[model samples]
Target chain A: MHPAPSVIFFSVLSGAGFGLLTLLGFGARATSQGWPAFVFFAVGFVLAVGGLLSATLHLANPKNAIYSFSQWRTSWLSREGISAVAALSLMGLYAALIIFFDIRVAPLGYVAGALCLFTVFTTAMIYTQIKAVPRWHQPLATPALFLSYALTGGALLAGAVAHAGFLFLLTALIQLWHWNGGDKAFRNAGTNMNTATGLKGAVRQFESPHTGDNYLLKEMVYVVGRKHAFKLRIIALLFAALIPSFMMLGEVKHLGALIAVALYFTGTFASRWLFFAEAEHVVGLYYGKR
Target chain B: MTALPETTQTKLGLVIDLDTCVGCHACVVSCKGWNTENYGAPLSDMDPYGQAEGTFLNRVHSYEVVPDLGTAQTVHFPKSCLHCEDAPCVTVCPTGASYKRTEDGIVLVNEDACMGCGLCAWACPYGARELDQAAGVMKKCTLCVDRIYNENLPEEDREPACVRTCPAGARHFGDLGDPDSDVSQLVAERGGIDLMPEQGTKPTNKYLPPRPKDTLDTDIDVLGPLLAPVAEQPKGFLGWLDRALEKL
Candidate 1:
């Protein structure tokens, strides 16, 4: 569960991008807070597309990624792809309409908004559906991620600041609750040495399967300290939710708004890092790394 | 194609016996040697000599099992892909690259279509799948699909490399789907159990547990306390030893 920097970047950047796009979809566009409609839309698009492109950074065959769009029927990953493409296209059309002809279609905005929400939902499901990583597989994961995206995106967008802030606080509390639950999830996941090997009686790893580092150890066995995680969680709560909530109460129409968004990004990045680092894969039991 | 068959025509898998495996790693090496050359792409290795860490489809792990009241035994456990009836690896593949064969039920990765997202490796509970860092693709035991189905090879050698090279005769290859098959019968007689049955993967592979030991059943003569040595004990060698000891 090593959090590849590229994936971490993709999740945080694309989340903010999609969040901004979701806000743009309501036809309540804003040119205030040093974010022009065109620039805003462009930045959001770039972040989403950039995040998508970044995900391919780890791919062995990036060329074959196009074929990935084919399995939308079964895979959550494919569903995410299709949703992202469709959402991006709808947002493109909406932006084009607003930019080119000085027109605004509320229905198109709503359509893009709905699709945007679906895209993020699919993204969250991609991790939640993985039963091996019990930490992410929970009933609370999807809503927590969805609310996080909306709150962050809403801050970058305009109107409903109070509503989004309140939701952000709720989700932030849930994130902390979910974070605590993840530790218990690994403990209560009920996977141990005996279960892994299907053997009876007391079993301990006398020797590792390999003498040196291998693919499984390199990829799955990530060890982050609990103390460090707690500190980061508090930092994430402070910037991602608390301070942003306080900022929403103040007049954050210009510089204050940018500062708030910056703080939120920093906070979200910390949480996302924990999301991967804390994930205990079942395979780790064999090596006694869990 | 990511969807598994309603029922596989043949559940082709290996039944590994833990009681006999000596942790020799012959099957591991033979598996690596055969699949690296036979398969679609080479099992890529980074710093294959300096790091000497190469992709291995089969891995032999040795563990010390100490029961509450019995002596400990070292068991060598060989693990690979179980090619489950409901393989999450295939379903999670965003592309139709990962699939289970309808003809033989050997789960395989279509390298041409694989994007190497490494999600399949993560989905697998048993550390069966591996990401080839050199090739930038996910690699795993293919049940030696290339060798198992190769008509060029002799009929006797049409088994997986691991089965053929296992010096201890710990690994067996056959269709586990048929109740009358040798492997199926072996499972019935030996009570071979699946690894992590709770995951509900319904793994085709089975591991035969180590045989129970009888601690109190010994046939050797028990030793008793010796009488004090006589002053004029025994003959030539015994006399010399006694004299030598008296001199000391």
Candidate 2:
């Protein structure tokens, strides 16, 4: 569970982007048309697309990314790619109709909004479906946390400060729950060195296959100290939830909202890093790591 | 195409004998050598002379097992792709690159289609797949698909490199799908077990558990009579010498 920067940025940024797009599709009014609408939609597009582009950085051969859209029937990653593209395309069209033609297609907006949320769900499923990592295998918690982050971030950007504050608190609670449950997920996964090796008694790894690190060790067996994780959790909560929540709830004006957004982004970034770093892959049991 | 086939015509896998592995990594080396040259992508090395990290399709791990009733035993566990019946690695591939052959039941990665997103590696519970840093594609044990089906070499040489190179005869390769197959019978006889059955991947590969140790009776010495004197005094010339020495 390597806390890869590209994936972290991709998930957090795109989650927020889709969240904003979902709001725009469903809540665009007459007064919010033209230049203002264009600006908001533009930001959404940049964040969504740019986040996707960053995700390609995680791929060693991104040139073959086009093929990634072909396996939606089985692969959550494929479903995610298709869903994101569909959501973005539909939202882009919906935005154009409202921003340029000054026409609001209610049905299109509703469909696009639903698709946007579905895209986030698919993105979350990419992690959730992995049985190897018990912490990320939460069918409910993983998606809930992702959606909460999206909605809260989206609400803040849409200037619904009160709504954003409420959502932020909810998200913080979910984050706490996820972290608390994740701490014990691996131990409770029923996988140990004995089960991994199918040995009768207490099994300990006497010798590893390689003297140096391998891809499996590097990618899945990443170890973060508990003390550092605790400190980062505090930082994540303080910036991502408490500070932003209080600021927005207190009806902070223009400058304060922008600062809140920055702080929230920083916090979400830390949270996303922990999402990967703390996850224990079952393969580690074979190595006697977990 | 990432969807698994309902049933494979044949389940070809390995039956590894843990009792006889001897902790020698010859299979690991032979697998690397054969696969690097023959497979879709050469198993690459990052710092061969210095760090010495490289991609290996097969690896041998040694474990110290302390049984409740017996002395601790060292077991050599050689691991590679199990080629599960319901292979998660295949299903998790965003591209149709990872797939199980409906014909032979061998799971393989189409290097041409692989984007190296590494979702497949993440999905595998056994840590079977490895992303080649140099080729930018996922690599795993193909069960020697090329060698097994190829009519190019001698018939006797048509097995996985690891199985062929195992000096201890710990590795057996054949169709496990057929109950009458040699490997299947070996598994049946030896009470071979899957790696992690709880995961429910339904792995095709099986490992023969190490035989129980310290079963011999240590209290009674079988060599006691052989080490004891044949007579109370000494026999023949030794008796005469003992008597003369006693007189002196």
Candidate 3:
């Protein structure tokens, strides 16, 4: 149920990117925020398109991605696909509305934000509905994805507001801590043999059910060493937790904020990859040896 | 000639017994043999000699259960698609490749429509559906639908390949909706149970409860306990510790 990094990045990045673009699309028409509007609009469009292409690459049959939109009534995946496409289309229309009609609709910004947030929810629910992948079923994944969107969006917003003053750094710092805390929750609700095997109070033992490897083991169990995990945990904490704090505090150079963004994206992508690799699907039971 | 009125209801399913099953896996082999030949594509084996890679519709798993300390008994559970009333797999299929008949509860796949997304397999808790790597489509137990409904087949032999070929007579096939059906009556008399009842799948197939070889009614000898010493231990550091623990 753990989507590939390409998928997770596609959701978190595009969601926040679209959300910010929608806000910018509305901002362009408002006489009050004219100069600032172009900045948000440019960045939003770049991130949205970039993230969408990244997501599309993960599909085995990209042409059939269009078919995914047809089953919204029964599938959250279809709902997510439809909403993402709709959100993108609306953003385009909003831009046209501002350019041609010279219309300034504040409610459009709110609607776009709502759509972006719903995309994130649908993305998270896709994993939550899975019965075998219990790690994704924890209460943590939904909130974690939501807060990640907010923090990522907020960081970009703070960078945008730097032209006004240094004041927005405080908000960015607070959001950074919130994002990292959610990441910790995601890591701590670790899936273990006790849950996977359903042994209860008894000790569960296994004799190599298969003589050789199969698909489940190859896909699910990554050969993540303890040393490597510890090392990566440090990296995740440093980027997601510490560097952002330093950047906001002005303890580092102004360019450090950009470094923080790079670090956060790289660290989160690695963590997401590990999340999928580390999770032991119960189907492993058919072939597992313990 | 005028057309006959169509029956409003048809219920298709399987019945499995827990008590009589010997865990031989004959049904598993028969199912694989029948489905591979009849389905969209044969269940291919990638490395037949080097590794096990063929697709299977049914698998017999063995579980050991102990009722008492005397001995443990092996429970053979043959699992496949349960054809549940609330099948999430059918609902989640985007291409309409997966569907459940309203007339009969049988969930089926249209191989031509399946894009090989592998979503239906994830939705199934029983691990019933498997991807046929060669065909690039999902496959599973059809309850021998082709054979069961074939008019050319003998009336006595019309059933799933697995049920018809079972050496132990462990599997039965019938309509549970009718209370008088043999499978239904047997289930009522034996007190069958569903695996993982909390899932709420409402599986049409029922497993007759396995009766343990031993029971809790075994008599305990009284003489061993009566012969044990009640007096204090020999006086030492160990004795003092033992006395202190006993005093509590």
TM-scores, in order shown? 0.92, 0.95, 0.75
Interface DockQ of each model: 0.60, 0.77, 0.12
Writing each residue's lDDT as its tens digit, candidate 3 over B1-248 gives 01111221555677777678887889988888888888567876667798766567787765554433555555566778887776767766666667776666677887766666676776665567877756666787888888888888898778999999999999999876677889888888877665444445566777776654554575766696888777556578888888899999
For model 3 the local lDDT of residue B138 reads 78
Candidate 3 lDDT, A88-153, residue by residue in tens: 677666655665566656677657656765666676676666655455554554445444543455
Off by over 4 Å in 2: A28-30, B227-248
Candidate 3 — which residues are off by over 4 angstroms?
A1-9, A12-16, A19-65, A96-105, A139-147, A150-154, A157-234, A251-254, A278-290, B1-11, B214-248
- Estimate the lDDT of model 1: 0.82
lDDT of each residue in B1-248, candidate 2, tens digit only: 98999998699999999999997899999999999889688999999899889899998998999988868889999999999999989999998999999988999999999999999999999999999999999999999998988899799889998999999999999999999999999999989999888777999999999876645656767898788866687779998999999999
Tens-digit lDDT string for candidate 1 (A149-228): 55465545544576657756775877877877777886677777887887777898889888878988878888755459
Residue-level lDDT tens digits of model 1 in B1-248? 68888898799999999989999899988988898888767787778678678788889888889878777888899999998988989999998899998988888998889998988998898989988777777788899887777899999788999999999999999999999999999888888998877777889998888878856565544442254446566679988898899998
lDDT of each: 0.82, 0.90, 0.61
TM-score, chain B, each candidate: 0.86, 0.90, 0.80
lDDT for model 2 comes to 0.90
What's the lDDT for residue A67 in model 2?
A: 96
Candidate 1 ranges with C-alpha deviation above 4 Å? A30-35, A224-227, B215-248
